[model samples]
Target: MSDPSMTTTGTMTSTRSLSYIALFAAVIAVFGLIPKIDLPFGVPITLQSLGIMLVGCLLGPKRAFYTIGLFLVAVALGLPLLSGGRGGIGVFVAPSAGFLLGWWVGAVVCGLCMRQFMRRMPDAKGKSLLIAAFLSSVIGGILAMYLFGILGLMLAAHLTLVQASLAVLAFIPGDLVKCVICAVLVQSVVRGMPAWRLDRD
Candidate 1:
């Protein structure tokens, strides 16, 4: 016979996971409120990248994937969820579409890397996270993200490879800054709530 306590615990875990997913999705939407700075080459810079970094670092692979998927679905539903309140199906065909794909991939990559890093780290909290988070963000948030962003520019915006790469450069500095912010925030959470365990794949 299954213990009633075990069943209750399992239910609570599932509920907590759903709550975290919803919270992160909303966080991404809130980040979209930051004004986007349009680049002459297309693809504006926004704080939404930072939110993506945080979601991955905090939520892990599976949850991070779901969180990004949820946010994108909401955008597809005509919600003004993208930066500058731009949303709807049109955005998917926009030059930023590739970057949208990046958000999905980047989050998972970041989470996977963070999980590995945390596992290996002896301290897990000292320099335990800041460096791990920063490096993971750079790998996933910047590198993985840029790969898709460039493709989006070329395919959606019809820019040449050279033009797309240059355009992507415009957003790199801001993305790096976001990485730093994400690292600090994740470290804070690790230190402050050492016991908080969210479902992470």
Candidate 2:
């Protein structure tokens, strides 16, 4: 027979994990509420990506991916949880769909990068945290997202690859700034609240 104590422990762990996932999902939704800056290409820039970066850095890969997945599910269900109160299944057919989908992929990549960095430099501090966070965010948050965003533009907007590439250039500067912010915030948490270090989980 299964041990009752073990079953209870497992249930508790699952509940805790679910709570964390819900919390991060809410964070993404909150970030999405930030006003968006519409660009000439019809794509708007928003702070939601910053939330993705933070989730990746703090939750690690598996949990971050699940968190993002939950957020996407909510948006798909017609909840006004995306930037500018956008949501519903129609979003999947929009020009930004690729970027939206990219959030999950990016979070996974970012989480993997963070996990590797933490393993290699277990005691990363100050500038080290910044360096780690920046590189991870660049690879996962920016590069991965661009790949999907470009594809989205090409398919949804019927733009040529070159045009899509050009369109994405406008977002690079802002994404870099977000990377810096994510890195700094992560470093602050790591330094000030050791017990809350998500990587340790």
lDDT of each: 0.88, 0.88
Question: Candidate 2, residues 1-201: lDDT per residue as tens digits?
Answer: 999999999999789778989999999999988898766666667899999998898888888889999999999999999988989999999997999888999988898898888888888888988999988899999999889999999999999999999988978888888999999988887878876654533
lDDT of 1 at 91: 90
Error of 2 at 172 (Å): 0.7
Task: Give the residue spans of candidate 2 off by over 4 A.
Answer: 1-9, 37-44, 197-201
82-133 in candidate 1: lDDT tens per residue?
8889899999998889999999999999998888887787456656568999
Candidate 1 — which pairs collide? none
Error of 1 at 34 (Å): 2.4
Candidate 2 lDDT trough over 10 residues, lowest sum: 192-201
TM-score per candidate, chains pooled: 0.91, 0.90
lDDT of 1 at 103: 94
